[model samples]
Target chain A: MLAGFELIKIAFVGGLISLDSTVFGQFMLSRPIVAGPVIGWLCGDIKTGLLIGAMIELLWVGVVPVGVGVPPDSAIVCIVATAIAANKVPDAAAIAIIFSVPLGVIFKRLDIAHRKWNRVFLPVVENGIENGRYHILTFVIWLGVFLSFIKSFLFLFICVFLFNAILSYILPFIISAPALVKGLQVFMFVLPVLGLASFLASFVK
Target chain B: MKNCNIIRTFFRSLLLQAVWNFERMQNVGFLYSIMPCLKEIYVTDENRLKNAAMRHFDFFNTHPYIANTIIALTLVLENETVAPTGLPSVAASEETKSQQIKSLKLHLGGPIAALGDTFFWARIKPFCGLIAAGYVFIRGFNNIGYFLIPSLIFIFLYNMPHIFFRFFGFWLGLKYKTDVVKIISNFKIQKISEIIRLAGIFVCIFVLIAYIVSSGKYRFAGVLVFLASFILIKKNVSIISVFWGLVIGCVGAGFLM
Candidate 1:
């Protein structure tokens, strides 16, 4: 039950997280194992953050952008899941995490779209180079960084709100049943198992 | 180039994918990085300056951190273009010189990118993650410091090697120019990655055992689930499908038992 301003703050942090993911220093502040717990600690639940972050980190440990291929973003999965689970009970986290998993691919598609739109700047850049306005290159670079921040800010804000509502509706049904509760308990171990599997698979000759 | 200009370019290289486009992935960023040097070199000739800018603006992509090596190499080549010595000390046209630089980037970008992908993206990162994960499993999650220490170490591991390459690698390229490739290859980056991967496999197995041990009553099921997921993942199943399938299966198993 976070306040509106609180959501804005977390989403603001999410935007900053987006910068390090790509299109910037890429210091990997956006990596799940880092950003997840940061967001979780921010939400007053460091354990949930660490748990979710580790899960996502292990699960997608094999995915790296090789050449032109963009891997699904593990950072977003952990961010959304940690935020959701930390703010609520741990029981609902498994489903929230699973549901948020698609966000990695969804963000990848948006990344592709944003990159596609970047073509419009080529003309502007070309014009600048011809006219000797080299400062425009710096401007465009900063503008790209700024736009990336805005996109992730809006994306996370909407996702946190939207997923909260959806999870609230769906979680009660799953949580109320004893069997489902048992399932949720075991579901905790499933992520690491799957995650480790992916890691081993990547190493397979 | 002035020390100040080199410093500026070094910082600018961090945004090497700032305006990445489908048409030319890192073209704008590449231009942006070398712009200061180009300006100083071609100050007297506006035409050369524009040509230089436009030349770098062509399609260019490489690992962002390791790009300093290429940028330094390009700076040397670009300087040579304006100098009478040229690349081979044989008379070469400006067009030929500029074309040479273009092909240099195009040719080197792929190999360096592959090396970077393996070295940083695949090997070092996973190795760091496993270490942090192993700590988490061993320490459990009783205190915030448990998470903080591992996270700090993980970030520290990644940044130490890369930041060194990003800043100092420029000198490697500057000193060697065309021979930078040979110098880079001398490091046997692929072999290092293989060693890192071997270490990562061991850390991963340790983490797995810790996780199962931590599961208490669910240890047997955890082993079963691990085997099933491992087999499926090894057999080429998409992770997300395997994830949801196992989630449903776990929930069902819990319900059935």
Candidate 2:
């Protein structure tokens, strides 16, 4: 398991990774396959990162950010889950993934809110143009990127803490229960298939 | 356009969605990317520049990469209407010329966005991701440090086309001007994506077979899970729910047995 200090650093990288989606680069750095393994290595558990990242990537394989459609924030799943699961037992990683998946959905809401909040910048630009302060454009654009960084940072920091606490509490019971362990392990193995199903569906649509 | 401004606009275009808002979606970024050229176009008349800037602040959205082409088209159109050097151009029909640019932008933004959505977002991006994911799933890296091989593959492959298109697309826009659309259509971007997508489908199936073969005891479950998800997604069930439901079911079923 990573230390408290280490978790903070991963959260910072997580913030930058989140930016690649729509905020700036669209570099696919935020993709689970990429972010997962990277964060995994950061946590000193490469296999765990690769495992979680590959599964999440396949799950959303066909999903694209067409128009205003916001896909699930799979990057969140990769970063948080891999960070939490790294070096822990394999079963614990599976548990981490289960909880972390929902966090992506939660982050999506914040993402929408951030975009809505960005409306404030538009009027600022209008004012800048009217007042002939062109430098304001550069300032506001960077500000948008900066604020997006902040949002992802805060989200990752909070999620890592809350999920760590919850998984810590529940993991003992699940480990003790043979049935639950077997079940989660099975889910881990099969999750990729579900991803393929969706991948195929994306083609059909 | 000066090479410096072209380069500047090309870099700025990367920030296309930085301040995206529902009200006017990419208008800010679009205006910002072309700001350098606008400065040059309206250098003599601050008022004209201001109007042009204000006009762009209105509603706008498009696929970010394809937008380079449109932005280039605007540069050509705006340059054409500008009176060369000292001529104080006719003010009456100038409104119509600017209006033509506006209409052109409005018309191009939506359709090109859809086309780009299909070409880049739908096919190209995923093909890169699929290949990378396929590598990870199949290769099963022995060295932890080697994990990045897939990531690097994805980055280099995707960016090769991405950079080429962003820069070249803009150049084509400048060269062809209004006829750039015809040039773009001639490329058959959608056709290329279709082929890439087919390749992706094969990669996907290949990965699935590898997973099933490796699963051993879980092979039957893997097959079942695959079919169940395909059907659910086909019926339009949301992925988040399907995922969460599967998690809960697996945990609960463990208890039931």
Deviating ranges (above 4 Å) for candidate 2:
B85-89, B141-145
Candidate 1 achieves a global lDDT of 0.84
Model 2 achieves a DockQ score of: 0.70
After TM-score superposition, the amount by which residue A27's alpha carbon in candidate 1 deviates from its true location, in angstroms, is 1.0
| Candidate 1 local lDDT, B160-245, one digit each (tens) | 98898787689889887888788888888788888888887887888888878887898888788888888888888888888889
RMSD to the hidden true structure, all candidates: 2.0, 2.0
- The per-model DockQ list reads 0.76, 0.70
Model 1, range A163-183, lDDT digits (tens) per residue?
877887787787778898888
Cα lDDT tens digits, model 2, B144-185, are: 357778878888888887777788889999888888888888
TM-score of each: 0.96, 0.95
Candidates' C-alpha lDDT: 0.84, 0.84
